[model samples]
Target: CRIQRGPYRCHEKTAGFNFNYTDDPNYGPFLVSVNGVAGNNTELTFWELLVQTGGNGTIIRPDVGIGCYIPEPNDRIILKFTEFVSGSHSVSGNSSNPGNLTAGNTSRLDSIELVVVNNISNTTNKTYSTDIAFRGVLIGAMRRLQTNSGFNFTYTDDPNYGPFLVSVNGVAGNNTEKTFWELLVQTGGNGTTIRPDVGIGCYIPKQNDRIILNFTKFTTNSASGSCTNPGVLLFLVGLFFCFLI
Candidate 1:
């Protein structure tokens, strides 16, 4: 609602943008067009909702839409006009609505376990339950843990890669030592583990997901080590940005 309301409040006072929207009773407000460019289904085009995080120019497409998204201070909202291939799904105008975000098949569990592990020193190892919103981003849950569970963390926002986990608690990663925190997750009935391609800013934690922050290093020429190849890591990160756009 702020996206729709802010312009009217400040249009006469400062430099701003204009937008058009429709108020759906069930989903609230949804963006129809921005700055006069509209999306047409016949043309396979739609308005894509994205945000550039405050202080950094790293852009990310949120899981929620205008109705539920609360922009933080200094956040630059982006309404990109995009076209998608037929038979392929995209995060279009309708897909970002509240109905698609919180409708049927959404997970029931609202809490996830976060395990912090220091593989190098093995000194600091603890777990906390991060209470999360339905389909909320991981960073929100992490902030909640820092506020309520005595957890502390810091990240470096990469212009190209979004937020990179720099440290957890008081432990910081060193570039010279080639050590950094790796994100992993365990899900499903048999506890299948996986390393998420996207970083904290874009990754949404699932119900009962066991998130593991393993402090480790990239091995030199080792095929079996975690994050064995830096090139592969970059490739995955590229895929993440491509999918979001």
Candidate 2:
């Protein structure tokens, strides 16, 4: 069997493995199974498409599905079996500023850096920066980026979780796809990064902080408490009490 051009074509022509996909009106074909294994939403498991770059041997997830992904000659294709957590909302990070700029001076404004990373896309990360008021929310800087730097993003305000980032730079996370923008930060540009327990509306950024907005899928084990977000917990508790009543 001769390997074909696209990923799905390659699978179709190859004899060793089997594959399956559902045709989506907007997104085209969505791969749901491979090698007799199927993705189960109830079990939170899915097949993640990945590629290893030829020369550098770096692994990356392609943003597009099998139908659209044209593999390079030397690219190593990998289909990974994985699980995901529910709920795309939530932002978290922490960083400090040692610079003298502060709101109290009224003359100097603090600025922080924003880096947009798309793990699923084979494109370069985009970097932008914006000035923030003293202890300003992340959304303000994001808005400034849109205004001055041409960077765009859209978010939904969760009544319980505040601002839930819905989309960034025209790429929106889909519930069926189980992908979202995760917020992370490097403190004082010292290289240490952390995911804050708070969302965008609650987390305050310090001067010179490097905020990383990573667009990626969620893959976590069930024992890790992935559904521990405050909003989800509250909803669960409310449902429990309603059942009791």
Candidate 3:
């Protein structure tokens, strides 16, 4: 027959005896197992039983997780993980130089050079040293009026013109005066002196003309004016006005 009882502890020597068969104390023995393994009865206190069941193992504090152990600023960490695992992680912290974390785009050119070639005949060859940003490029002639003669002048884009202010070479009637004359000088027109009768005349000063072509205001990439202070053209104009009077 089966018997039921409240919690009870038996001494080690009598642990295997069936309490239900107390009347016939020696009638049968009880089977005992620890973690699903058959075992002979042995003496054990409650504390010992608890230890055998993993109660003494280290316990992780709830507040401290994997991230808590990371070192402070300037400490380097080498991380090796597969792409899938790495994708799950994120970084957050205050940096010494916060701007280093921001992403920006910048571009730089390889090499830049500015070249201005004057094709006029009378002016001397000149090469101006300038920064990369100021290089002006235009495929045309530079036209201006001679300060001395008040005659329209044409500065060629060819080597003959050299690099100088556009102006007439000399006085109009002088035999030696070779004026750098142009038929019609107008602003914003094709750099050409198109007088059909003169057949594109470029003033050639003869020897007798005492007047000289003066460079007043000269510039590229923008129109010439007092505000810009094209000193070369101003000089030319000053020389022409002085000679004309």
Question: Highest lDDT: which candidate?
Answer: 1
List candidate 1 segments past 4 Å from native.
1-33, 36-100, 103-109, 220-245
Which candidate's TM-score is highest? 1
Model 2 per-residue lDDT tens digits across residues 116-165? 88979866899997887554556766776788776999876432223567
Clashing pairs in 1: none
Task: Write the residue-wise lDDT of candidate 3 on 9-67 in tens digits.
Answer: 22234343332201111111112332333322232101101111123443221111111
Ranking by lDDT: 1, 2, 3
Q: In candidate 3, how many Å is residue 129 off?
A: 4.4
- The candidate, 1 or 3, that scores higher on TM-score is 1
Clashing residue pairs, backbone N/CA/C < 3 A, model 2: 63-120, 92-196, 93-196
Off by over 4 Å in 2: 1-108, 221-245
Error of model 3, residue 40, in angstroms: 81
Candidate 3 off by > 4 Å? 1-110, 129-245
Candidate 3 local accuracy as lDDT? 0.20
TM-scores of the models, in the order given: 0.54, 0.48, 0.12
Worst 10 residues of 2 by lDDT: 89-98
Q: What is the C-alpha lDDT of each candidate?
A: 0.58, 0.56, 0.20
lDDT of each residue in 42-131, candidate 1, tens digit only: 675666677899977898876555544445667887777776543344323234333344444344438799999886996757999877
